[model samples]
Target: MEDSYRHKGMRRQLVKVVRSKGIKDERVLDAIGKIPRHFFFENALVEHAYQDKAFPIGAGQTISQPYTVAFQTELLNVKPGDKVLEIGTGSGYQSIVLLELGAEVYTIEYQKELYERTRFALPEMGYKANFFFGDGSLGLPRFAPYDKIIVTAGAPTVPDALIDQLKVNGCLVIPVGNAKTQQMLRLTRLEGNKLRKEVFHDFKFVPLLGDDGWKK
Candidate 1:
């Protein structure tokens, strides 16, 4: 009964928040409503799961706010059955959203603590993303040519490794900036060795750590 009420409130907030934020994609909106956010957090957050604010999930990382998550997912332009690669699987919320939208998810998490917690939390939520414990800045080369790649972390610049992993006409939505802040960027592989890029939004996230990102 409590879970039902919580999910109901979350669904209501999801619609109100996404629409007000100008995320006009119907599919994205539906996916946001369908996924249950409380499942990703500990019992304490089941009530506040509907709020449009980032929440602490330990290890100095956070589960992104609803507006941010909705905005970013809409930017991905996801379609059913698409294969998605997600960098920085904090709390596994982004991965869950992508999966709910009918994408085959392959996610990477750099923090061991967060990764394990997410690994346990995700299965219970009815998702089956291939989760990896590694450096997210180094795109998962083994699964090259993803249909869509979404990086939740912010880098100083676009990672060439990630670019190389994109399929023809595939897209990668990432953030690029310095230690203090970052700007969201979208890179799309056109064709025949040509690529196109665009800036999506101005947002902040923890620095993406690895060879292809900020040193810190």
Candidate 2:
């Protein structure tokens, strides 16, 4: 809960590292620099918080590496007041980043433990977002037509439900491939509801669990 001067300094360095990795969005970099990444880590793992690495949180999930978070956020192209749906909330670090970028975030998690923990923990740290517990790969249809969507876990394929929930011209950023390696993909919902897909770098993530994802 405490972010010291040293932590701020470390986050600055982490932002620089993310920038060097080709994350060109200054808004994303600013959010990375401003948030205290260590707050998402256990006391014992605080030393690894700003090292541009993913660390296990619990329930076989991870607080994504800073670079990965920044990469996805940049691809999301969040605009102020944009409605964003976040899948696999995990440690809630990425939600905080979207909030910092002035997005209205609706985040869902598949694990009950992580959902409950982050729901309480984030607001305690003065960050707020709509939190939901369910199968995130199915998408939060109750609040469909989001301006942007981000999936933090790897899926065997893009979930049709998520694409269906995006507003026309909305963007969905997700990793699609196998359980161990996924190619990051950005799918934009075009005017006719057709999708324009762009593939990016490969990454490894915990499998996204739900009906539309890997079987739990």
Best by lDDT: 2
| lDDT per residue as tens, model 2, 1-216 | 788999998888888899998989888899999998888877888789999999988899989999999999999999999999999999999999999999999999999999999999999989999999999999999888899999999999999999999999999999999977999999999988889999999999999999999987
Error of 1 at 51 (Å): 1.0
- Cα lDDT of model 2 overall? 0.94
Root-mean-square deviation of each candidate, in angstroms? Answer: 1.7, 0.8
How high is the CA lDDT of each candidate model? Answer: 0.84, 0.94
Q: Show where candidate 2 strays beyond 4 Å.
A: none
Model 1 is weakest, by summed lDDT over 10 consecutive residues, at: 1-10
What is the Å distance of residue 97 in model 2 from its true position? Answer: 0.5
Let me know the TM-score candidate 1 reaches against the reference structure.
0.94
Off by over 4 Å in 1: none
Q: Write candidate 1's Cα lDDT for 1-216 as tens digits.
A: 135865877787767877898989887777778777776666876766777778888887889887888888988998889999999999998888898888999999888999998887788766788999998888999988899999998788888899899999999999888777778888889978688878766888877877787665
